[model samples]
Target chain A: MTDVPPPASESQEIWRRRRGRNRALILVLAALAALFFAISIVKLAQHPDLFTISLDGPNPSAVQKAPAKP
Target chain B: MNTSFAETTVAGGGEQSPPSHSVAFANETELADWIALLKPRVMSLVVFTGLIGVLVAPGAINPVLAFTAVLCIAVGAGACGAINMWYDRDIDALMRRTRNRPIPAGRMPPGPALGFGITLAAASVLLMFIATNAVAAGVLALSIGFYVFVYTMWLKRRTPQNIVIGGAAGAFPAVIGWAAVTGSVAPLPLVLFAIVFFWTPAHFWSLALYANSDYAAAGVPMLPVVAGAKETRRQIMLYALILVPVSLVPWAMGFSGPVYGAAAAVLGAGFLVSTWRVLRDRQDAAGSSLTNDAPARAAFRYSIAYLFILFAALAVDRLVG
Candidate 1:
């Protein structure tokens, strides 16, 4: 395949990937991130309501899913 | 030089026309170039794995933050890929696989690309911090540092396993995405991380199977170049063997449904079969299925699909059930 030109800026992808290093990091940073300012924008997008995970239902009973391909 | 693929292509009459001068007049980068910049293909896989981490984790964040977090992760991934392209533009111009990239193709200057990458990196990290937390932001900073410094600057020029060690940069988004929602790391996320981490060797070496010519032409020390096809195939198969079970960790841990487990099983086995083809056959004389009959290309393509599908299933299980 021929090489494609890069239209987007490079640094942004790096910034996005780096945030995953730690778990506590996500929470502490998010609470402080002031992304709430972006709440208006976030609310406008798809699947905005984040459910607090609490499992209290019947067992999933291990239903082997198929492998993923994109 | 390991000119096998390119050599064979030429032998098989895969005619080489000179670089099309017409492209100069065309001026504007085609759609593929911009797609290359967003690193959309990479973004798809990285985003999928990150989604897995986000979904399988036990806690949750505000939906807004979560979306913002995933968005940041995708942006950050694209940013890193762009900078990598920018930094490697010189060598990129030499290899067949990358010779047509915007920077290398002379569609854009390296300086502007570098500027663009740096700006995106800074913006994404800042956004991560502002939208999420310091930890995630810091991780963002460090991920860029590692990719730019460790992988791009240090390891790539220095070793063949550059892709192996450097693979860490690609795997971080999942944890970042998970943390964005849950606000903390846990066993499940680590398991997810491990799956991607281990899968890297098997996934990349197959591409190297066919791309070794470009690598050799560029003097890059890819595994197929350094170790030869036989050894590389062995390594691919070995990694695939290990990755299959590792890929199943989420299902084994009860985080996903049986559907996910089934998918992982089938795909993992398919990965093994493809790698095994590379390992068992030597039809390219030294090369195998990956290099010759174009199965390696298929494996390379499937590997991308495999990672995406695997992670997507995890997200579906979490969200749907």
Candidate 2:
């Protein structure tokens, strides 16, 4: 087959690749977010008071929630 | 340095002009432009200060949560920077200092930058809420909103007092960091907030002193542009005077020990000396408008170092106490 010249304007192709890169960035960020949530869940399970930490007054659950000594 | 995104060709039925450049990355430089949109240098300060907030608080914070909090704060700050760049593209192009920014340079489109910023902002808030508490999450959201709406969109263009009031947004990280740990605000973090709030004017004004021409060209209403250099210098000295004493409140309140107190005293003295030099710096012995901004430049660099050291002392005091 005879050689065919590419489109005169490469701007379209450049933007398409950029959009693709953006999509990849979004996916990577989403995966990181998912991992963050997973780790958060695990920490919350290990220490129930992790998120409910209060500085104002004594926390009853905090004493109980403290990890047991080996 | 094109000011108009409204530039359009008459041929396409008066339709919007095609983007001058593609947003796609054909090289590492193009990718770097996207990173530049986030203002990583500013983001680093956010991360450092936010991490210190979490570290020095008198409570236990999970490593994972602390990481999440700092990450969210950094991302949120970056989001605001991106949005600021997008909104200020017109003026940014007009200014010598900012003309090379991604959107202004036409390396990236405004629409994409806005979308990237909003998405990061939403994700950051959601992550903070999920990983931390409502108070921290709410503060994070407010900081982002204040930076984007109150600072960038509203105050920046309207008033010479813009950076003064707008500085509060940068101060939120201390509270957010403390809130992440305590899940509530406290006097000490408020004091930290005050330190940053006061530091902003001196820090920004010094840069504006040197960059006055750029702000004037862009019609940005910066203090140096509207109020004259004399007033700007006076205000910088006044702020430095206020910041030094205010920074000592944590030590006086007994939260921090002598180490912090001594460090604050020394750093505060250095800060005063820097600003005083800026104030006294005038026409040379031969009587010329002080062409070299040595004092202002020294003050500007010292201001950054002063903040970092002050926080470091706070952290050290927490350990040593």
Candidate 3:
């Protein structure tokens, strides 16, 4: 079946609503991102050791020196 | 119900049938319609009480996390409202007060509204868990489930005691807020829950008394519609009487200071007077108001203000005491 185009007034109304919906979605996403960021900062502050990562390997001296290889 | 939104085009004017699965219909809804689905007015009360719960709880929470907890409560409450609107669209269409909701008015399809609600509900619970504790998140999820399942789907249409039982869903925010900080429920938060629980029937029945016709038209068995206006008025008074003492429980239990006790007493007295006026409003033997249900309307308005002020007093007392 062939498609029929909507009338001008109806098309304009549809565009208006679509634009509004798009804007609202953008605002909501931005707000959620900001909220998540704030929550992360607060949680990290409350428990600084929550994500502790030791950059240094185990003390080489503390480990017995392996004999020069086999 | 089976109409595909993608297949349907918008006609010039009038309400359209809801689409089954798509949202590409001509009457793409505006942002305001989506906001309307959230029921922001109801969210305001939930947020206020939840905030008070946080403030009055006996512990310290980071301000950011506290705000997040309240935000989650508000969003969760709004999610329930959106789902309720979706489920009740049929009855909403019949009721004068709700005929203009987005789904019933045909500005938006039901699919998107339901999706929006479920998405928000899940997100709120997840966010609450992330920002607060497991207990807070669990209570938040329970509140959403109680509202969507127990109240909206089950009890709303089946019984006149719907408000009485369903009010527990609304009472959860205070407990949720307390849990967010303390990570557990306390006697104080439970008392606050009781206060809101008892306060709800009087608050809603006052509105139902005046809007009896709308409920009757919609075939929703609100108390006034099922039990007659006279019985509803007496029930309203009974709840009001119970609510006054319940509201004072925090002070009586030594959880609050004298400021709260005094405010609760004064507010409870005012509430009783308001309900008493409603009980004695000019009505025939059948309890239908001859004077346009003005006293019920007044009582309805007073109930909202009463809760706001009473909670504010509690918060203030906690802070100052």
Instruction: Give the candidate number with the greatest TM-score.
Output: 3
Tens digit per residue, CA lDDT, model 3, B112-188? 89999999999999999999999999999999999999999999999999999999999999999999999999899
Q: Write model 2 residue lDDT over A13-49, tens digit each, in one string.
A: 5666567668768988797978777766867787786
* Model 3 per-residue lDDT tens digits across residues A35-62: 8899888878887665555559654545
| Top lDDT prediction, candidate number | 3
* Runs with alpha carbons beyond 4 Å of true place in candidate 3: A58-70, B1-27
Ranking by DockQ: 3, 2, 1
Shift of residue B229 alpha carbon in model 2, Å: 0.5
lDDT of 2 by residue, B153-208 (tens): 99999999999999999999988999998999999999999999999999999999
- Of the pair 2 and 3, which is ahead by lDDT? 3
lDDT of 1 at B149: 88
Model 1 lDDT per residue over B201-297, tens place: 8778888887788898888899989888778878878878888998898888887888889889998888888877767764656554433736667
Quote the RMSD, in angstroms, for model 1. 15.7
Q: What is candidate 2's DockQ?
A: 0.11
* Clash count for each candidate, listed in order shown: 50, 0, 0
Worst 10 residues of 2 chain B by lDDT: B3-12
lDDT of model 1, residue B256:
81
